[model samples]
Target: MLKTGSHIQINDTTLRDGEQAPGVVFTLAEKVAIARELAAAGVDEIEAGTPAMGDEEVEGIAAVVSQNFCTRVTAWCRLSETDVDAALRAGVKHVNISAPMSRLQMRVKLKAEPDEVAARVTRVIGYAREKGLEVALGGEDSSRADLRDIGLIAGAAAKLGVFRFRFADTLGLLDPFSTYEYIKRLRDETDLPIEFHGHNDLGLATANTLAAIRAGASAASVTVLGLGERAGNAPLEEVAVALPRTADARTGVDPTRLMELCDLVAKASRDSIPRAKPIVGADIFTHESGIHVAGLLHDVRTYQGLDPAMLGRRHKVVIGKHSGLAAVRSVCAAVGLDLDNSVAARVLARVKNIAKTTKTLVPDARVRSVARQELEGAETRDMAPARAELRLHP
Candidate 1:
């Protein structure tokens, strides 16, 4: 149902929500470096940080803003004039003013009702506009809120000239189907652009994000490596790579730079990127299974789904317990050892045994050793037969 070639804006929140992950913090230099990388990766916007966190946060956000990258840099703020003042000090031209959308959050966090929340949104947005700041309204805990309340709140913000409305699945609660319906309903309420922000508690953030875009969201809020509070947010790499294929949508993001960008974030955050992570993972394109490798050898399309070349990487073949003769032959050729079928078969058995015993892929050095030993043994046996024939003839 999506319109093909729709342009989706990628608003990266790695500096804001990503740092909210417990025990995670980025130095000012790291923040600037990350911002530069995000810009180079062609993200549309960067949510720098919460300015209201105090002077240090303001300074960090300002440092990133000073870089003057082509990507628009925005600050996340509370629905308060004081936060807006801090954003101004941080020198960002845009701000995302967040307010609780659910009754539970409104009563518990802000001690206010729907009307009161609406009034606060109006006051803060008006103040931000007067200060020459572009504003976006962020609906916190929107997944659990009433659709009517969301419409009312977003309608008020629209009247005040907010550029976008962000529907945040703050608790990561909704599935894709529900996400689609929720976003579709919101899309009908007002003419404002809707951005979808998802959490990964149920491991469905990426899926939910795609659903929201299909339903009507034109912008996606994502963090590098899905780093954020609790389980985390939807990952930037996953969402960017998935958009074109899943929703017939595209972002300005460059797929090739995703790995380098993710690596920089992982190192700065002191977190390790999981080897199996999609798009940016170290092993996503690696193959070892016999059937898969055999198919890949015949025609890469037989077993290939995502082409690694798109991401500036290539398919890697390794020797493992599940590896077959095709894999062994391919790997050996890479290491400058071309083995015939019989020698390859012998090498395969040894590689499997070593992999099973070590509970890991057999290293290339070990494979080469085993292959050379097999080839030498084959030659010795052949020479022995010829020697016996010569002795018998004499």
Candidate 2:
């Protein structure tokens, strides 16, 4: 487990990896805007873009760099001198130089053996350092690579004074157990700061990332909404919020601004935020179930795990098929209606019927109307009993 108060660095790759999601693109203005928001949200670094993508990408990266935000802005680059040159042109002081780590990638992508791959990575790290670029070496497909080979390359990069070694679960194939073991073994390899870059193909990126951190990785590479190639990468919001709670660690991220930042990215990418998405989801704090709403009414802690107020939001109670009398009364009271027990029960019945028919939450307006009708009927019934008693007395 991570030590208490361990500060995990958040390296957000929203502009680079996030935009790589199929059919997703960000305009220059949007890129700057996102970088601004990311800095304001207290990310430790922003992977602006891959400078090697060409002038357009370089310009985009440069635009973010020109903003001079306090957060470090870094460029992604392949393990080549040409890529490093592109990064310099983009005016970024830091660069993450990537190399194929798995034997399959080395044989197919680089067409080399272990010795040749190690030589190439060392040469690039030296060249980048000579060019005055702060460097982090990224091990592509590290999950499939042998631990010895990872140590070899990272150990070599360390000699040249690289700042960190990024172990990427490039295919998102590792579970939390495997992730912890891999990172733990890698820790014995080199003294370089270890950063974990995880993918979501297995839907375990966040879990794997946490495991890696517990095993001694100091940094997490993430993107907004988990947006990336294939399934996506580890989500920034999930990792940031979960670190303190689950790992006894903390990040610089502000949970309160996460929703706004996520909404901004979702809109720019033309992707709708899933209403049930964790952390920033619209319905994450919305309650409609009978048991849950009753529990919340009695004591919020009964149904509460993550506090919505931490994200600058509150719990919302809506009447639906699963709603109980407590939820109905709460909804009615919100609209300036007072429902006695009898009226509340009648309104809840109507709500369930309406919700069943519509296959949706019963609107507050409709609930108010039903409450009014029930109240009028109850009043008429009460007056009749008094009138009969008076007639008998006369």
Candidate 3:
């Protein structure tokens, strides 16, 4: 378990790895605007972009850097002089220099042996330091790499004065239990700051990230909306929100602004946020089930585990097929209709019918129309009598 007051660094890579998502691209203006918002939200760092992409990307990164936001702006780079040169040209002071760590990636991707690759990492990182750039060694595919190789990479990073060592679950293969054990072993091996970068292919990115922090990772790499290659990376919102509750780790990010920030990123990236996405979703806080809505109406804590107020949001009740008399009464009251038991039953039937046919919650206008029609009927004349009977039954 993490001790109290663990300050977890959130290094957002929305502008870098996020753009790698197919058919997603943020204009230079969008990049800077998003960076500004992230800074205002108190994100610790921003992985601006891959400077080596070309002049356009370099300019975008430079624009973000020029803003001089309180957050540290860094560029992502491969282990090569060309990539380092691109970052230098973009005027970024910090760079995450990544090299493949797994045996398959070594032979297939880099075509080099473990010792040779380690030597190359040393040489490249050394050269980067010479250029006065702050460096973080990205151990790509660390989840699949041998524990000994991970230790070797950490050892190299420590010896070269790398500020951080990132363990990349590039394939998103590990679960929370495995992730905890992995990071715990690495923590025992080195005193250097360990950062966990996770992908969400298995829908475990946020879970695995939390486990890593609990096991002693100092920072987490995340992307807004979990935007990245394949299923994307760990979402910034989920990780930031979960940190405080799960690991006793604190992030500087303002939870209230997470929805707004994610909206901007979704628009810029053309990736719509899921309606049930954690924290920033449109309907995650909306309750339609009768049991849940009734419980919430009684006491919010009875049904809500994570307080929506933390994100400047509140639980919402929608009248649907599953809604009960409590929900119907609540909606009627909101629309200024005094609903007796009989009227409530009539309105609930309509609500259920509408939801059943349309497969959606009854619209407010429709509910009001139904209520007015029901109230004008002869059955409503007995509403007062019905309530007396209802009270007696209670």
Candidate 4:
């Protein structure tokens, strides 16, 4: 667990590298809104965009940087000096200088040797620094690169007064254990600040990112709703909310703004947030089991992990197949229906029958209405006219 005392800096890449995801393109207005949301939410850095993509991208990056949202805006770039120049021209005070790290990528793709690439990395950092921009050196496919060579590239950049060494899981090849070991070794051997970037090819990016943080990574590259190329990167909201509760780490993020970012990003990308996604998803804190609802009614911590209030969410006790008497009673109480034992059992059995008959989760309204009918029947049969006490079962 992190000490919960250190300042956890979140670096949101939603506008820049996140757009690299297939079929994603953010308009200038969307980019501006995202940047504003990121800033308002207290993200430490925003990878605004790649100005080198030309006029539109440059204008977008400039618009974000000029917002004065109290966040550092960075632009991504290739190893070319002109890319750095473009970022500078776009008013980005921070630049991520990327280089292919794997032998396959460096030679086969870039057709450049390590010596040549290392020299280029150092040159870009130097030029970016001279241009009054902080330089973050990115290791594209760094996980697949030979460790010794990566160390050399990272070390060379560090010697040049670069800001940080960005180690990437370009292919999502790393699991948590491997990520821990690799990140630990890198941290142990280098004084450069390390930032970990993970992709979700194996559905392990968030897990690996957590491992990397535990192994001394100072920063991470994340996107809203895990948006990125291929399988996607770690979801920024998950990392933001999960870290504080489980690892006892502290991120300077506004918990309330977390879901809003998800919504904003989803709208901008023309995508929808998955209902079952953790932290920012619609159903993460929604409860349906009768037993689960009873527990929540007693104390929200019964089945909940992180507090829903942290994310500007309310506790939702949903009535479904698994619910029992107490769950029904709780919902009834909320709706001003208190049920007795007999009423509770009847309601519970009816809910179960409804669930079985439909083979689907029963919605809260139908369960409550059925319970109300039973309560009305019980009143008509009795002379005392006592209040209905409901106990819903799971």
C-alpha lDDT score of every prediction, in listed order: 0.92, 0.92, 0.89, 0.85
Report the lDDT tens digits of candidate 1 across residue range 24-64: 89999999999999999999999999999999999999999
Go through the candidates in order and give the C-alpha RMSD of each one to the true structure.
Answer: 2.7, 2.8, 5.5, 6.4
**TM-scores of all candidate predictions against the true structure:** 0.96, 0.96, 0.94, 0.92
Residue 291's lDDT within candidate 1 is: 96
RMSD in angstroms between candidate 3 and the native structure over all alpha carbons: 5.5
Per model, state how many residue pairs clash. 0, 0, 0, 20
* Error in Å for residue 226 of model 2: 0.4
- Which regions of candidate 3 fall more than 4 Å away from where they truly are? 17-19, 379-394
Q: What tens-digit string does per-residue lDDT give for candidate 3 at 180-236?
A: 999999877777888999998999999999999999998999998888889889999
Candidate number that wins on TM-score, 3 or 4: 3
- Residue pairs with colliding backbones in model 3 are none
Give the per-residue Cα lDDT of candidate 4 at 219. Answer: 88
Clash pairs detected, candidate 2: none
- Across residues 298-350, which tens digit of lDDT does each residue of candidate 2 receive? 99999989999899999988888899998888877887889888789888888
lDDT, residue 381, model 4: 87
lDDT score at residue 369, model 3, on the 0-100 scale:
86
Model 2 has a clash total of: 0
Model 4 Cα lDDT, one tens digit per residue, 1-394: 2455666678989998444578889889999998899899999999998888898889999999889778888899988888988887899778889999899999987788888888878787888788888888899998998877888888889887887888999999999999999988887657788889999999998998888888888887888888888899988888887766545577788989888887888887778888898887788888887677777778888888778887778878766678778878877888898899999999989988988899887787888899889998898888666789999999
